[model samples]
Target: MKQTRISVLAVFLVLAMATAALAATEVRMVGDALVYGSFFSNRNFTGWNAPAWTSATPTWSKAGKKTEEAFEIWERFRLRTDFVANEAVKFRLEMKVEDTWGHGTFTAANPEVAIMIYGAYLQFKLPCTDVDVTAGLQNVALPQSKMFYGSPVFGDRMAALVVKAPLIDKTLSVMAGYGRLIDTNRTYDTTTTQVADELDAYFLALPITLDGFKATPWGAVAVAGKDANLFTLKSSQQNSSFYADNLTSAGTYATPKLWKNDQNAFWWAGGAFEVSALDPVKFYADVIYGAGAESDRKKSHRSGWFMDAGVEYTGWDVLTPKAYGWWSTGEDGSTANGSERMPMIRPNWGPGNSFLFDDSQELVKNSNMGMSPVGSWGLGVTLDDVSFVQKLTHRLTFLFVNGTNSARAIRTLNTLMGSNPYFQMGRDLTINEHVYGVNFDNKYMIYENLSAVVETGWAHGEFQQSVWGHSLVNQSRNGDTWKVSFGLSYKF
Candidate 1:
């Protein structure tokens, strides 16, 4: 039924485009041609003998070898056309289709789809300086980080109306707009009956120039509608024993308390600055803060911030050496109790099983991934070889996460009411973990429009908990993973 609905929507969109094309006076089309392909090999080690230094046992891993190999292809096509061009108003239409095919751990057969208004709106350019007014489904502007407010998860698509003007002696431009959060390609289950309405207002100030330094300050507030239902909350009452069918039986009853109020709102603000301090050194830094609870049932308010500061130096005079370091923190604010503060999901473990579902520190069995109070700091040194063969880039990065073992959210879930074995299946399995890895990528242009690439990586870490519990005995293990891949691609 869901698939049928999606197909009907697609057909309706096509017909609408056709009708618009026939009625337009002036038309222009633009697009891009792209073909991308890659191959990969993956391997994971989990079980009693897994890494010992990271804390916890491997409930998801058994003493064995698990591997997967596959290839993938990516293609995208876009079309844009202008319908009306006049002195006071101009209108345009845009459409795009993207498809993918592949195998392996990173591969999926289901092609992702996105359909949007694109540029199907009107723009009124005024005579004063460079000012414009835009209405209808238009582009929403935010800060430097694409992850905030925008569709960073899949594709960028939000509904909004924007106004543009010049400021600061014409040295700065400002954009203010109102937008709403719409369901993306991935929608929740309709049976859930929970809907969320998010309305946001954003403002951006971009300085034209400041002594050769560029800076921008952006801010936004998202007001959730009163009817928004964040998450389902339930409580259970357990009875030790009851007489049933001539036998003693234990019964558990769960009750639901429906919460229908919109006391939750989120505020986000940040700025970024870039400057060239010396002949060989360039500095950049960005800071962002977000606060407010996503739901009221938990009576929990989430607040976190992130900072990215780095300096890059280029040695163009010699080997063209490059070195830089980055630091990032803060949560994504998707979980009720701030589950983003953990690294259990999609950890960079070199080509091995991430054991994402086997986290012992997570209270919830299945949860979204995000930054745990833990922050990652890493430094990399890269050397570019442009003299011969294709451009060769070699990079080495070292990262460390703080507060890895401090995830009380997962710990509390496991110990709920104490001695609940079902809830403890994979809880508190591992403690703080330290990961180190090396990645190498080589790209060579086989022809004018074709290229060949080779990449490989290796990582090793220790687990901090026992895989199996034995009387008076606790044990841990160490593990390592590696992967290699080669592929060819064509671009136009």
Candidate 2:
């Protein structure tokens, strides 16, 4: 009887060990680094010393001193680690560090550099089914074509849960997600006992793919409490005001304020399509409509439409030529009727390497000279991947932008605010204003995973004094602006 009991215990232990071995986890890591220095002038299109020209009343540019030389170096690094338990389950974590060259170092007598958690998520396949689910913080974007980089409504990192299921193998699928945009500590609100200052969004997408064509139709809805944190929608560092003036009717354009209601509703619908049936000649396009509604405050509401299209020819062995254009509804003369500009949460849309918009810049940081095309229309052309020698390539681009917003709207806002509303002069233009830009960028592969880059761009602005007023226009030196950046990138 004693031997029989011992044999049974040994068998149990053996089975446990076998199960553990079968479930062994695999770990993988990937990362990238970038270091760059940028030399720029007239970054604001108003000279380098424009900051010293501020006053209670707008003054003339000649009364202030201006400079044209400025330089800075920036560095960024990111690492992602993935742990796979099997073909069915996985977990990923990403960390990032980005800042000026010498600011955040303990040895430099400053605060120690901070490491940020860029993403952390778990992904798994449902039991007895093909459905896939991902939960936690991750990068999210609405349905959009690659030509414009991402959606014009919301494209960034957020805490969310996403699920995807294939309806017809690899040809058709459906995706759904929920993202939390803001949370002002509802559980810890000391005043009013219960607070409703949170924002949440839900989305759905349908994707269809054929032999040489693909399309995705998507829609989203968000609920925002009246006191939701608006600052959460802005980038860590911005070239100019993000939604300040674009949220037109909230108050005045010069000093806009948010109007409140118990709860606000925002909705968006869009579609992205790509066609490659024509081989070397390919086409891509996206159309979107978005709106915000408030029950009590009519001036707090906004709605509009936006669309963009692009064509690319990849027949040549050394170069690919592309053309892109975009249009969107803009504000009119009335303030009580609310803004006509398309409502956006955090837009990340652009085309090519043009400096006028936040396109594909190897630097990615401190180089976004142009704001999102909220109330604007543009046309651009690019000659991409022009290689004349081994491991060396160049890209040249030219772009033109014109405002779609009415000048009368700005004029009225300035009068109501009793201040200069042209603070974002070159960034936010009127229908009577325009700007053109050119870019010449170069890249040389140092190794299979390393490259050297050089980017240069220039922009010229055309503004009308009749719309912006002499005081604001004279205070701004709206001459040409330019920049030259050199950088190195390494990846594995």
Candidate with the greatest lDDT versus the true structure: 2
lDDT of 2 at 423: 32
- Tens digits of per-residue lDDT, candidate 2, 1-492, equal 354355456445634644564557777779999999987777656653322213212222331245644787878888787778889998887877787766663225544546677898999999989999999999888889888887778777789999999999889999999998778675676586576667788999999999889999999998766555543334322434433233324332223345555567888999999999998999999999888764546666788899999999999989999999999987787766777888777667788878777656787776756555778899999999999899999999998999988887766765554333233456667888888889899999999999999999898887767665564466454557778999999998
Model 1 C-alpha lDDT per residue in residues 316-392, reported as the tens digit of each score: 53334444433444223122444232111011111111112111111111111112212344444444332443344
Clashing pairs in 2: none
In candidate 1, position 173 carries an lDDT of 78
Using TM-score, give the best candidate's number: 2
TM-score of 2: 0.86
Query: Model 1 lDDT vs. the true structure?
Result: 0.39
Error of 1 at 458 (Å): 4.7
